[model samples]
Target chain A: GAGVSQSPRYKVAKRGQDVALRCDPISGHVSLFWYQQALGQGPEFLTYFQNEAQLDKSGLPSDRFFAERPEGSVSTLKIQRTQQEDSAVYLCASSRPPGEKLFFGSGTQLSVL
Target chain B: EDKVVQSPLSLVVHEGDTVTLNCSYEVTNFRSLLWYKQEKKAPTFLFMLTSSGIEKKSGRLSSILDKKELSSILNITATQTGDSAIYLCAAKGYGGATNKLIFGTGTLLAVQP
Candidate 1:
């Protein structure tokens, strides 16, 4: 089966620009998650979705960060006014349910200049 | 707040050697622990350990979870150069609308031929 897939394998944006990263979860996956990983650090939770409803966004670093899963199988993590600190690898993962093994996407490397 | 910590930031080993990675977590309503091997991109799921299944093995990889200690260990026997990558550990936090994963800093493994 195809695993989770993320688009724009790499992205480069100027500071203050807006960027939206896309994630296509595995077919029929009910749960999706987003994470950010900075160099030399582990991936940090950004948000979560169960079906088409987002249930958690506490991990989002700031108000500029937003996410949505309108169709349940696809999600997008949008960063408004990208900053240098936001330059990290944005990873997407999906699972049949919470607490189960998650399949991950290659991730979008976001570089803010 | 939940947190995951991994010991030995990095390790270097030769093919045919054995290695073990550690993960300790502090989280409320712990659901399960997971191990992943990440090369240059996404993480590849290796194992998932819950109370019901605290031990799991696959090929040269095996993992055990100690709920009482809130820790887990991943052991690889007869390591090969292909096994070189970042080993990540994550703990699932329970009792939420969506399960959230807390990740450790990860252990960088370098296998030499």
Candidate 2:
């Protein structure tokens, strides 16, 4: 079975640029999540989606960060006006439902200069 | 604030040794605890413990959750160099309000050959 997958393993962007990271969750998974992992630290929550609806975005550090999962399978995390502080690996994970085990993607390592 | 905390931010052990990792949390709507292992890329799921399923074991790795204490412990027997990675703990909140996974700082394990 295919696990979660992410595109563009690495990305380099200048400050104030916009970046979009994509994630493909396993088929039929109802819950999707995005996280930001800074160097030498664990991943921080970003947002979550159930089905095609965006349920939570409280974890988004600022308004510049937005994510969407239309049709409930493919998701994208877009960060507008990138900053050096946002330089980190963006991770995506999916689970059948809340409280279930989550499967994670390889992640996109974004380096903002 | 709701948070997950992991102890022993880093550990260095030789192959065949035993190791233990800890995770504690403080959240209003406690649901479940999860464990993950990561090496350079995305995190791999290790275990998910809820109120009913408190203890889980897979080969050399085992984990237990103490709901009363709001904590969990992961034990690895006969640690191997391949087990060297960062161990993360996350807590899921209850209710239908978006399954946000709050994460701990993580423990970096370096198993020496």
Candidate 3:
């Protein structure tokens, strides 16, 4: 599919382990977003980027949660020293500039033990 | 804080029944209201309502936004078993440099055969 692509569909890591989740947005889609969805809950915004510049990350739970879009096309969300509470599905979505609708990837289900 | 609230956390209905979902929100610089359906992994975009009073429809699904009341409603008529999924309501807000979406917990709908 030409939609957003997420890697490591599922991840299991012991507490204190660091994890990295990747997302490849649709070609030429300028706006990228990261969201966290816990079981039985809607996705919560985590960060936003436009062409390599991360403009917003106010929704990040802590400093340990860091995201970056180095080239503005691909993004990575890195969680350092993971906690059990961090278990959730991390979703990636992209939209064209002046974005009104979003295209989402299947998401990475991260499980921290 | 920007937030979206949805009513009837869960619902079960016969295949031929009609159902209505409600969503209300409060946010700074509200840009749009969006709906998505999540079956298992990816959340598929259903509708994006920006202008008030104009209802957007697609087959059995229709949605309307009300800026005066800061709310929206989604109606699905003669729903099928395939309509069983978690329906998400999100409010897009523009504050600072981010145009992020704040989502409600979601309404779980089960259309029984």
Candidate 4:
């Protein structure tokens, strides 16, 4: 694709429900990252992947938050038993290499009601 | 823990006015500092500063990093209404296997026409 693409630009989920957010990065991007942006705050790193390997997941807030990039081109962020505190924007970004410029997606706004 | 702080939570300025955004960071193994602009959905990349002293300029936007002071500044010359957005500052750090970014709260800039 021309740029990073994310699905379900907006989502409304009830508490305790699970939600899945998808991201399709630029073709052949070697590094993919997931971030969460709260209202009136900057994006916080969630996880990182190099190719198909999940190298880092240190920033995932809790055990309920999980992300995976099985094939390296596309990724998914799954939140289990969502809570009101999870209502925020989930952003995905990609870079050619570890220390290169990143391209971001439009993001999925999750509203837990 | 790595931390990034940006000054002036919000600013309102008239068109053609120049604005300077400040960012400071304290991190171990700092790799780079980045600037991003967020409007409606996602944040767009602006500049990445690695070395100190050298300024990176893109038309009306310019940024410089001061490694000695552990800070960076983004300057916009003759700002426009289109430039009204949240300016974010992030610092990249290498921890274990992957590099992670720590972002500040961001500065909301509103340019009045």
Highest lDDT model number: 3
Question: Where does candidate 2 stray beyond 4 Å?
Answer: B52-54
Evaluated on CA atoms against the true complex, candidate 2 attains a DockQ of 0.79
* C-alpha RMSD of each candidate structure in angstroms: 1.5, 1.6, 1.0, 1.0
Scanning candidate 1 chain B in windows of ten residues, the lowest lDDT window is B47-56
For model 2, the local distance difference test gives 0.90
lDDT of each: 0.91, 0.90, 0.94, 0.93
Highest DockQ among the candidates is held by which one?
3
Ranking by lDDT: 3, 4, 1, 2
Per-residue lDDT tens digits of candidate 2, residues A1-113?
A: 38899988999999999999999998888999999999988888888898888888888999999899887889999999999999999999898964378889999999999
Fraction of true A-B contacts recovered by candidate 1: 0.89
TM-score for the A-chain in each candidate structure: 0.96, 0.96, 0.98, 0.98
| Clashes by residue pair, model 2 | none
TM-score of each: 0.95, 0.95, 0.97, 0.97
**Which model, 2 or 4, shows the larger DockQ?**
4
lDDT for predicted candidate 1 compared with the true structure: 0.91
Candidate 1 Cα deviation (angstroms), residue A86? 0.4
- Every model's TM-score on chain B: 0.95, 0.95, 0.97, 0.97
- Winner on TM-score between 1 and 3 is 3
Cα lDDT for residue B91, model 3? 91
Error of 4 at B13 (Å): 0.6
> Model 4, which residues run further than 4 Å from truth?
none
lDDT tens readout by residue for model 1, A9-80: 999999999999999998988989999999989999889999988888889999999999987778999999
Q: List the lowest-lDDT window of 10 residues for candidate 2 chain B.
A: B46-55
* Per-residue error (Å), model 3, residue A72: 1.4
